[model samples]
Target: MEFDYTMTTIKPFDVAVLAVEEEIVKAGMRVLYVHDVQKSLVEKGFQRDQFKIVEFCNAKYANEFLNADIKIGLCMPCKINVYVKDGEAFISGMRPIVLSQFFPHADLGEMPKEIDQIIRNIIDNAK
Candidate 1:
């Protein structure tokens, strides 16, 4: 089966970012940070396209996992990358639920699926 990590939108990056931010909070999660990855790359003197990364987490779910296995901290603060190239915009991020398969304790729990649906909605509804 093919796993999805990235998505495209007809809207420009600015509008898409707004939709993504609104969708995340509407899902009852708070955004942690919005990283300017393209700027970071530009500062390093490498020519690159524009890219923004939005990170977010829900405290309740986060705590549930931490209470299960501390190692899962490695994937905390799940994020989405918003970028524009050739006049097209896109949002990209790892499927935590899919990757959670490696951590049976976390996968078996309902939290991953709960969060996955929210993330999926954010991606699916963003314009």
Candidate 2:
């Protein structure tokens, strides 16, 4: 099975970042943090492609997963990344269904599929 979902666009990196943040909110999720990876690297005198990590979560989903298995917290607060590479901006996120493979004993039910669609929609909309 595919491990991730990604969309590429010619849009500027900054514009892509904003689009992702808005899309997360539009999906009824909260943005927990936006990590400016490029800036962090620049601070240490390294230059790199533009990159931002957008961390977000839907409280109900988070609670359900955690209550089912505390270990799910390791992947809590899904993340989408907007980054530039070879002159193209890309949006990518992990496929939630992969979690099932990682925790077969946990009763995640249909959540992974539900969340997978939501996350794919978020990335597609943003792109």
The TM-score leader among the candidates is 2
Clashes of each: 0, 0
lDDT of 2 by residue, 1-127 (tens): 8999999977788888898999999999999999999999999999999999999999999999999899999998899999988888899999999999999999999999999999999998888
Q: How many backbone clashes are present in model 1?
A: 0
lDDT of 2 at 29: 95
List the pairs of residues colliding in candidate 2: none
* TM-scores of the candidates in the order shown: 0.88, 0.97
Runs in model 2 lying further than 4 Å from the true structure: none
Residues 3-100 of candidate 1 have per-residue lDDT tens digits of 55678898877788888899989988899999888889999998777889999989988888777788788888889889988867888777767646
The best candidate by lDDT is 2
